[model samples]
Target: MAEIAFPKDAMRVLKETSRTFYIPITFLQKELKYSVASAYLIFRAIDEIEDHADLDNVVKYEILQQVSELFERPFNNEEYFRILEPVKSIMPDVTIRLEEWLQACPMDVRPIVADAAREMAWGMAKWSKANWNIRTREDLDDYTYYVAGLVGVMLSDLWAHYADEKTDRDLAIGYGRGLQAVNILRNEEEDLGERGVSFVPDGWTRAELFEYAEENLAKADEYMKSLHKKSILLFCRLPLALAHKTLNAMKEGREKMTRAEVEQTVEEIQSE
Candidate 1:
């Protein structure tokens, strides 16, 4: 058997198209890296399927079914295992996580992504599901939490494996949920732009955003305070910070978010 490359392309694929996770996961001990990376790659692929319009629903369904099949078998062909092939060249620790992502499958989630892919799928689905049921804003809120809040739940599970006696297992879910909540509020502008939907910023005012931020941040801080590990904090830092920053950006952008300002903000983040 060959070794795995771990942090190389396989992880690079995991890192692509995001400023949030790449640098942060590196803060962990060597043993924890690939499991986190593997989970990310699977989730990211699912995201692509949902986000990419070029791919048709039938193709997406096939990809989803392939994910189901991959989990049922520990062994896969090079194409299905493309993400792992590079890692197998230089990294040995990857074998375990690679197996985990391949073995366990969840159904209540019916989440088209992998069974193990996390709540983000549910949340995104709910966001779209809102189109048919647009009677109340609370319904919209429920959708965001499903897709994003579940991220908190899965992160807790992943973190629990690496934490020692000092870890506060009790608080992992709260922290994850906090992170998701902040994201939902931050994306209010983007959500409205893309879906013509508004779970928040019904009127788009700085005062409302500030109050919402204060409320959500209070909850996030509670979870952060509950955390006993520095690694988790480091992982939590950039996103929650960026989420907070995005809100401030929206306020600075005011009601009319110009194309230039959003592009500049994204560029600044990528360079950072």
Candidate 2:
């Protein structure tokens, strides 16, 4: 693979958006790193619109649908800018500069990333239309699949492209669900207090949700154990390790792992 410069601005936005992903991405080989970073930022851009505090559900649905339509066609800078113009002023920088992130991907894999993002945007639109109602276990599964599980499927494709590596697609979805479930747990307070949304099922408690996360994480472990590439393994393991530790911390009544604990976990992963 030829060398490609990962954009500095993309890296800066990535670090601002997600510390967990930013750390693992830095460990990937150059081309793979660029591809993964681009994909992540693409998803994060639409995700901000989906989770925006001020946007009405109807407005979110409209914007996300337009985004999905934009991804369906060939890349056009003018079209994207026009499509997003109505709410650009209110949107975050990550969401506003989505075109930059799209162009940053390795050309060969850009379509793959775009297609995955299109599906995710459409899914977000669906959930927003429904007001993000999670009434049952199946609803939770479907919601997570759209938002996060598709991410696993997309990454699996990227791995195959870059490393000639094949992963069990089912386990990959579990990997994403596990991580997303942990996020739901960690943000339960904010999700309810700020957004008035609850990802937990109709009658499920924290313990039930904990069990859900652990089950999917077991699949994530299987997915990681099957990897032969050291870089890929490290990339996958770093987040999984943190997810587990975060769950443990939550169990002990802590909202999340402290900065010191996060650094300690990274060091431990590096040592392993």
Clashes of each: 12, 0
Q: Write the per-residue lDDT of candidate 2 for residues 151-250, one digit (tens) a residue.
A: 9999999999999999999999999999999999999999999989999999998899999999999999999877889888889999999999999999
Give all TM-scores, in the order shown: 0.61, 0.97
TM accuracy, model 1: 0.61
Cα lDDT tens digits, model 1, 26-99, are 76555455556556666665555444434444444444444445645344546455643432333333332444
Leading candidate by lDDT: 2
After the best TM-score superposition of candidate 1, give how far the Cα of residue 160 lies from its true spot, in angstroms. Answer: 1.9
RMSD of model 1 against the true structure: 8.6
Each model's C-alpha lDDT?
A: 0.50, 0.92
Residue 220 alpha-carbon offset, candidate 1, angstroms = 1.6
